[model samples]
Target: MAERASDVVPSSAATSHSDRGRMNIGQVLDVLRPDFGGITIPKIRFLEDKGLIKPERTPAGYRKFSVADVERLRYILRMQRDHYLPLKVIGEHLEAIDRGLEPPPIEAVVPTVPTVALNSDGLPSAESFARRSDVRLSRRELIKIAEISEELLAQLEQFGLISPRPGTGHYDTDALVIAQTARELADFGFEPRHLRAFKTAADREVGLVEQVVAPLKRGRDSAAQGRVADAVSEIAALSVRLHATLVKNGLHGA
Candidate 1:
């Protein structure tokens, strides 16, 4: 379900700065940070590290927050509060919005995959058929897609299945793909203990498949999406028919 915009838009503690030049950055952060769990100066640096906030540097290279920066901070807060999103997801969400695209639904965009049980002819079960054919994920995103408990992620990492990179809890896209693969392997009697290359292979594989989904990931309005989906469906159907002819006949042979 889509959250109401108000539920996700950060509220301003801004005193309506008519003079954007003089707002003390720390004062603004303090007023806004408390709502986000007593956030401190370190949190600001962390958010900066995550690239969610970009403050101006003074002549001496000190950070300075303008009105715009404050709003961006508020946006960061809203993402964490309303979406329970990791920094990477939230950062990209804000970036797309700033670039004039609709933010992709956080839950709808999990990074995965494996072959489910094969049916008679070396194909996945009907319930797990093609999976849009190119679902990709990392170890971290696999957990997110599965909606598994965080404790499970921690356990996987404790076994070195994946690492929470640096200071951010956000998993790399590679982690998501690997995790999904690991889950599938686990079903076939492989465990995190068995796959040394799961993590690295996932990172590499996800990039290869992600190129296909990149176009779909571009955000759009409903009407625009409907048009694109219709076109894609039509093209896909035509391609399938074209495949039948090529497979069975001598039209335009190679």
Candidate 2:
């Protein structure tokens, strides 16, 4: 027999009314339906079945959802609707949160280069270069979004031009940018092998920046750390501008 919504008790005599801020299945729907019009009891139950959520059960088998549970459901739904992330990926994010580790970044549904990366002059500023993006993409997602073939991605990985986050098996915004740039360069008959030089040059530039900031970073004060960050950002931005200007002149001379 199908269980009616009324069968679930929000607060029974056995369960203290003030025991906790718990909501029955019907109330849960009311709270979530505003944002998730399509959310149904079965859908919530399905999530529970998938181990994405765990709501307490009353002695009579009524489901009781807590505030935290509702928030978790909201997050899961938003990730699905906004980013098209798979349940497995969402589960991984929840697991990371539970373990007190930072989860992989969630890219905006419509992917684009971050506006913060550019200044009014149409060049990257120190703040832009210093700002870290919070975009993460799975292998397949990166390939499709970057419009690159699997073989090409493998080549990029081999050349160390792009890589996934250390332990997350997900690509960050830097990887996405590199992939897109490589694809565009491929039009000029440039392969990943040719890009290795750029990677080498980038590493050298990074080493220079690190040397400049090493002394500032040694200071234990917060102000010292702030200065270190500012120095790295400013120097990195300048290095990029210099590299771009040199390349432009070289191209014109060639």
- Model 1: per-residue lDDT, tens digit, 1-254? 43322334323556454254635657776657667666678877888887887887889978877766776777776777777778888776666455333456666663223334444653233333223432333344457675555665666777777775566554544455456666677678875666755456545544554454457657676576655455444444444455456656875574
* Pairs of colliding residues, candidate 1: 112-136, 112-137, 137-176, 137-177, 138-175, 138-176, 138-177, 139-175, 139-176, 139-179
Best by TM-score: 2
The TM-score between candidate 1 and the true structure equals 0.38
Instruction: Give the worst 10-residue stretch by lDDT in candidate 1.
Output: 126-135
Candidate whose lDDT is highest? 2
The list of candidate 1 runs beyond 4 A from truth reads 1-12, 18-22, 110-254
- Alpha-carbon runs more than 4 Å astray in model 2: 1-30, 33-43, 52-116, 120-122
Position 89, candidate 1: lDDT: 81
- Please give, for residues 1-254, the per-residue lDDT of candidate 2 as tens digits: 21111223432321342265688888777777877899999999999999999999999999988866777787788778877889988887676455333445564332333333576666689988778776567787789878999999999999999999998998877798899999999999999999999999999999999998998888988799789888998999899889988998999999
lDDT of 1: 0.58
- Each candidate structure's TM-score, on Cα atoms with residue i matched to residue i, is 0.38, 0.64
